[model samples]
Target chain A: MNAPAQPVLEVRNLSKSLGGKLILDDVSLTLNKGELKVLIGPSGGGKSTLLQCVHYLHRPDRGDVFLEGRSAAEMGRRNICAFRQEIGMIFQDFNLFDHLDAENNVAIALRKVKGLAKAAALARARAELDRVGLADKADLFPAQLSGGQKQRVSIARALAMDPKVMLLDEPTSALDPDLIGEVLNVVADLARGGMTMLMATHQIGFARRLTREIIFMENGRIIETGRPDDLLAPASESRAAAFCAKLTELLGH
Target chain B: MFDLAYYQTLWPRLFSGFWLSLSTIIPAALAGLAIGVVVGTVRGAMFPRFLVAPLNAYVSLFRGTALVVQLFVCYYGLPQLAMWLKPFFAARGLPELWRIFYLSPYAASVLIFALCSGAYHSEYIRGAILSIKKGQFAAARALGFTQAQTFWNIIVPQAARRAWPGCGNEIVYLIKYSSLAYIVTFKELTGTAMTLANSSFRYAETFFAAGLYYLFMTTLAAWIMRRLEKAYAVPGFGRG
Candidate 1:
């Protein structure tokens, strides 16, 4: 009935290497409108590199990425900036500009990239911060906030851009166990709200509860792909199930 | 013997010299800092190596040479070079080009001081810029900020904060080295003191008072720098 809504994001045969090491070999995925997909894999399996390549932070060696049906390779420099603005990225380090307070962190791209007026940008930024439940902490600097709070502020910063899709690269890996839940909660809410997203994370329980599609990668290739019920079942022989089991065993969760 | 009466008589001449020193130091310090920030930002950003290399050479040239030599070249050597190049200019119908090289002593002193201080300040700024984590630049780029916008708005501001103390030290040094202006007959504080001591033969008293003036200036500069560091500091940074 809906005509399949032209896949919101499509990555076809994206390949990359760093320092002569093959980091992503013929990696590919597609995300339809409002759908969330999880990338799970062992360390050095290219999950982070794949997200970066999707964002064009790392140029691919082969193949193409399309956003809303337009190939990123076809875009000029000016168009690339506009294209990047449409995709928000969250880093593992939670890179909120250290000099700015939480509110300015959210408002900066709105003012600089989008050219919003100071008063209007600040108002929108405050609303985003409130959405992340950080309204009272808006005045604080990154160093003054906890790990969870910094990640939330970063999430608010990205949300302020009104990105068409979000790329989160292990947004909670650097956080303490206690701080991880708060950042996960904000992310889970974004998922429920139907913001298209591709996340690289090791939190299997969280992934299982939220998304159906799982992509398992290893040594720069996708080793397995399926729903959590099929791949993550207790007795499944899939690599994804084994990897999730190993992660659970190590984390003792 | 302090010789209070003679020192009193000499006060007016010393005050005028002090005023000249203040005027020279103020403009030179401000110009040097501005140049450093501009040049250092270019060096720190991802500009082509060919472009950044010449600026690096400019820094090395100023830092490697003596300030006295630089002052002499700008004030004295330039006129000689201009005289030699006058024939070349004349062939091009530009006879007045030589006259541009004849800088007033005041101008020459300020030029040398500013350039020398700028070289030092630029090193501090470039180091600070490099010290900032790469993640900041990556984050700005991810937000769709152009390269120039990211450097000016994000990188430069943080680098300026980190480089403040080093730049402040250069100002203190400038206050003391300003005495060198006397070498080219600009007749700043030390020049005035030497003249008074020669006339009255009160060498010890005259020179001692001049020394006190420099000490007062350096101390004042230190206090001002401390206040500025406090004022511009972002809370929760550089803390344990």
Candidate 2:
């Protein structure tokens, strides 16, 4: 049979080192269009580093990341910006501009980058906030929001960009237990809605339920990759099974 | 020798001097802050690396030198330099007007003071810009903002709030440094007090009056800045 169609995002020998310590070492992956890929690994295994490289937040030290077949490393500033418009990345810290209220935070990129008029941006912001179930919180500053709410606002801000691909880096990790469910619910809804996403997370059950494919990483390398059930099934000998067992023990699951 | 009568006698002269000082201080401080915001934003945005380095060098040179030197340069040095280029300036028919504008000691002093303080203020502004979390810039970029749009729309306003306290300190220093303008013969509050004290031979009383004026001005400035800080601070966020 013919090889499956090329993925929407393709990595070829991508590598990065921070201060002479290898953070990502010769990592390669393919993300098919509309695929929900979960990257699960022990801490410092370079899952977030991989997402950041894809987001162009950190340039890979060696090799290439291609977005829709265009080399991200070769794109100039303007092209990079245009490429970024189509790819949204959420942070664990929820990096909202504190001076802006929730609505303005969402509206800013629309107004400044998209060149939308203020009224149009504001309307779009309101719509996105409503989607995140935060219509009433539009005027609230990030400082006023709980960790979960801030993360949701960050999600809305990303969604407002109308991105084709979204990368979430430990989206619920910073939230309190009571708040984690709220953010995870939002991500679940997005995944169910068929938004293309790459999420690095420790929420193993959520990963298994929400994602079609799961990739297990160790020491800056992909140790195993397969369908979620195939790798997570009781009879599996995949390294992912051992990794999940250890993670479950660590999380007291 | 302590005399309530001396204070009474000194009050009017001191009051007039205070008013003169404020006239120079307020306008120069306002102008300096505006220039600083522009320069700081430009430098922070890292526009045209060539331009940024030279602008940075200019800011550093002014901040590194004494304000007195800047005043002397603007007042005494500029005219000499202008005369050297008189052939070019006169051909353009701008030299005479420029000389007339600079001839007034008060105008030249205020101009120099504004330029000097603006340089230091820009440094504070740059520091504030740099202090913002890197993640904010990343988010802006991810949202499709160009470098310029990210700075003006997201960064500068946030940095302004962060930079306010430093800018307030600069404002207080500007007021105090207005006294230096007396050297250029501007006859502001300190200049008037000095001349009056010399003429009256009551140095202690006249100088005491000047001190009181400064105390009042500084107190008012501090109060206003505190209010500003409270207004701009994100509620529930730590002062960091």
Candidate 3:
């Protein structure tokens, strides 16, 4: 694949530690516009931390993230807020505002941050919810919805922002096995529509089918990066391939 | 024996005192809630130390003291403070500052109740705010909400819902405690009852009637609060 002249998102030597323990070390990756990359590894491999650091939720102790070629390290507090607005984040737990119903959850950021009027924001929210096939569930609170429905509402909430790029940290990890497909379908549709995305997920089969490249991380470092076909080939010696074989054996994928 | 004619005359005076009590309780409750919410949000959200220090002091001071003492300080102690500062005001050519210290019994009673209840209310609100899941805060921040917007729009509303029962208890406490207002010469229900009983030498009947009045007020206030709690409750949140 020919690389774009400038990447839409870039992580430069990002490092982070929690409670005096390093979680991510010297992690660097670039995401060109409209590219969807998957981060795969064992639990506690720093994939979630990498996504969070890029979003500045857990500020990196060292290193920088650039969006559209602007360094986050150089941005002021207000500019950081503006920068965060451009990059949407999805969480493993769905994290829908428990107090708000589905429609309000989708509309809140538009009304609050984007300064869209309530009527316009709600209209936009409805459209986004409709896209997720949850238009009928707009008035339901998070607790009232099933896990799959809740995840879709959260995705609608993130999509309503019209984000330049999206960081999804195990968007389907918290779902019941039978419920995972609905959430994955929405994510797959987003990829097909050319929304730039970086995702950390354990569903190797889904990653193999949809992602442009598969990134393997372990012990706070990226171990290997390659196309799914090349990395997961039966005869390959890559760690990702070995991990996938074990995973496939255990889950019969 | 209940004195029918005497009781008939007492009723009008008791009604007037009840009206005064009502006026005091309403504003004090509203103002106290406003102060509690603002103070609670600031403290819970972990604002800068300088601002938090004084608020911490305010909460500690109010909660630690007796309500009667706080009422006394507002009604009586301020005048003494004014006397001490009279020379300073005079030297500064602001003699009007003395008037600020000379609070009327009514004003002083409301002020004391609001401050004391506000302290308790803030504790409840702060606890509720802290109890919220951290993910919501992270999500709001990730969505580009400023700290203030996240606290007000996302955090505070949910906190308020969780804090509702606690705040409602404070309001009931406020209603019952409004009787103490008469201690400051405010001529509220208890004060009027005391005066009438002393003059008529009818302590038992008069005080019993007063007790009934208080019971009525507390019961009414409790019912109103329950209705409000029901109305304000969001679906799938808080106890039914």
The CA lDDT of each predicted structure is: 0.89, 0.86, 0.91
**CA deviation > 4 Å runs, candidate 3:** A1-6, A245-252, B87-99
Better of 1 and 3 by lDDT: 3
DockQ of each: 0.71, 0.57, 0.71
| Cα error, candidate 3, residue A113 (Å) | 1.9
Query: Which residue pairs in model 3 clash with each other?
Result: none
After superposition of all CA atoms, the RMSD between model 3 and the true structure is 2.4
lDDT tens per residue, model 1, A51-87: 9889988778998999999999888888888888889
Model 2, residue B189: C-alpha shift (Å): 1.5
lDDT of 1 at A126: 97
> Residue-wise lDDT of candidate 1 within B1-240, one digit each (tens)?
889887667667688888888889999999999888878877876679998999999999999988888999999999998899889988899758788889999999999899988888888888889889899988998898988788877887788788888899989999998899999989889988988899989987888888888888889999999888887788655522
Chain A TM per prediction: 0.98, 0.94, 0.97
* Candidate 3: tens digits of C-alpha lDDT, residues A1-253: 9665559999999999999999999999999888999999999999999999999988899999999999999998898888899999999998889999999999999999999999999999999999999999999889899999999998898889989999999998898999999999999999999899999998999999998699999999999999999998988899999999988998897
Fraction of native contacts, model 2:
0.77
Task: Mark the 10 consecutive residues where model 3 chain B has the least summed lDDT.
Answer: B231-240
Model 1, C-alpha of A195: deviation from truth (Å): 1.1
How close to the true structure is residue B153 of candidate 3, measured as C-alpha lDDT?
93
As for candidate 2, its clashing pairs are none
Candidate 2, after superposition: displacement of residue B217 in Å? 4.5
Local distance difference test, candidate 3:
0.91
